[model samples]
Target: MPKIPAMTTYDAHPMHDRVVLITGGAQGVGRGIAQAVLGAGGSVMIGDLDKEAGAACLQEWQVGDRAAFRQLDVSRESSVRRWVDAALARFGRIDGLVNNAGIADPLREPLHTLPLEKWNRYINTNLTGAFLCSKYTLPALNKANGAIINIASTRALQSEPDTEAYAASKGGLVALTHAMAVSVGPSVRVNAILPGWIVTDAWQKPQKRHTPKLSRIDHQQHPAGRVGTPEDIGALAVYLLSSAAGFVTGQHFVVDGGMTVKMQYA
Candidate 1:
């Protein structure tokens, strides 16, 4: 009989020597993921439309050559292409991509009052942006057998009033995840993370950063007993991008502190 292998402790740097590109990485969830990748001994190239926030991230991280940042408008193909080219130039290869950029505001005018321009804005930034990033990065990702993580929202599965545009955009992102997964499998992996109520007050730019305000009821409402944080999403992202999740693909993982699973009676 063959002897059983001994179990080992978890690796501290599972992403060593890897490089990941994160869109809208200057703040919020994107910033959290970038920090996690760097913490796991991986490099990062952050692309965001906010130049000040991007510079702030670079200054704060101080990871030297292991991290880079560029202003990117993911909704524009030229901007996406430039960002991708810049990343490859700096890191030489791409190991993962995180499509985390989108307008955070969910409240919009009533669907009947919503203008076509407003709806298009959400779709262009949230859905088309991911497509552009993936399209331009696919070649490099394929060569490296990398992964893609789309930062969708729990709104995709559920919605509230005045959230039509945001909900639809996220729902489209969830569908895009599976479609891309099937289209790029065997060489590249694609997945989505639906986050719920993550408090990003402290994850913003220096001028905008502040302590999050929460009430006891807020903490008690979630089955997890607390509101979520950027780190919560970041930790999962690191795992999904690592070899530990090699078998996982074309799936949407909800990291909403069990809020979505709870039944609420009006």
Candidate 2:
């Protein structure tokens, strides 16, 4: 009989020496991913629209040189370009890009009452933002053979009322993930993460941060026996951005505490 191999210790810094660029990384899920990358021994360049939040993150993280913040509006191509340029200049290389910026509000005016401007707002920020970031960072990513992780929503798969615009944007993001995966394969990997019911009340900026008010039903409803957190998504983001996921590409991973797989009745 063959002898069993000795167990190996888990690696604490899977992303050591690497650099990642995260948009909307000043707070919420983006901030969680940023912290995860740092914990994995990677550097981060964070871009967000909220200057105050960005400053707060910088102050709280205290990771000198390893973390940076830039004010960015991902909807604008020029802003995206500058953010990419800054990251490349600061870190000299970008091994990963996390497109985590977007309007998080799902319930808007009803579709019939939703104006075209509001719809455009969703598309421009949520969908086009990813495109612009990908477009600007592709060259650097290609050089490093990096990865792109789009933070799509499970709303793309299942939705509530008054979520048409948000759903469409995330659904488009899902399609974009696969399309880009095929288009840029063998050089840079692209993927999407669909998160559901992640409690971000405590993940916000200083002024906005608060303890999450969750009910027993919220934890019990999920097959995983708990509500999801930003860290849950962060762990997967690290994996998807690492060498271990070399064979994984063009996939949409649902990180929702198994909520999507469970059946529900009215």
Candidate 3:
């Protein structure tokens, strides 16, 4: 196995006592990030449209430890503002906001045949949602000199059949990250993380099956020789949110296991 780069020092829990909010933290990568921050002794707020799951995560992680839950609709300005406000009210400050909530409806049709409604839905939920959340949370983040980590995808750089909306939305997110980083200026740091194929429970669905037909064991055939886990993304999220990454901003960091760098000639 290859060594993963130690992006930042653990340093006795660098983000301890800080307040962090993660959208869509009910499960998958967002949940993973929440756990990571909690473990590091930071307060966390889990925001999502799924009330049950979000509440469950809050109960399970106990953000007030400090941790809590907030029902949020990223596409709605009012909803987004409420959650940010709630986090600030609960913790008295905001240290970071992870725009990790997103939706991707599988499409069988090409762009020419794709439904306009579907395209709009994708852009609204995946792209515009992130923008709205950031816009509202910027003030809180600026107050804490915090970071905004937008969860993008490696698909932003590559394309797949029937994945036009997902790719386009993520691509737009990457651009937004840079623009936000510049706009937030010397106060708040904004960056994008492009995660590759991660086999989460949601990803286990037949409709969400990954391509190239490789077995679980062959996951490591690429340079790093394995599929990624939510924990991997979580660790990186923690680092980026911590003071250790103060010098990093306005960048798109790819966390794939070298899959994009390899060519399949077979």
| Number of the top TM-score candidate | 1
The Cα local distance difference test for each model comes to: 0.95, 0.95, 0.83
Across 152-228, the per-residue lDDT of candidate 3 in tens digits comes to 99999987687888889999999999999999978999889999877576422234335445586668675898888
Clashing pairs in 3: 63-66, 63-67, 64-67, 220-225, 220-226
**Model 1: per-residue Cα lDDT over 238-258, one tens digit each:** 999998889999999999999
**Estimated TM-score for each candidate:** 0.97, 0.96, 0.88
Please report the TM-score between candidate 3 and the true structure: 0.88
Task: State the number of backbone clashes in model 3.
Answer: 5
- Which residue segments of model 2 deviate by more than 4 Å? 1-10
Please say which candidate is ahead in TM-score: 2 or 3: 2
Maximum-lDDT candidate: 1
Query: How far is 218's C-alpha from truth in model 1 (Å)?
Result: 1.2
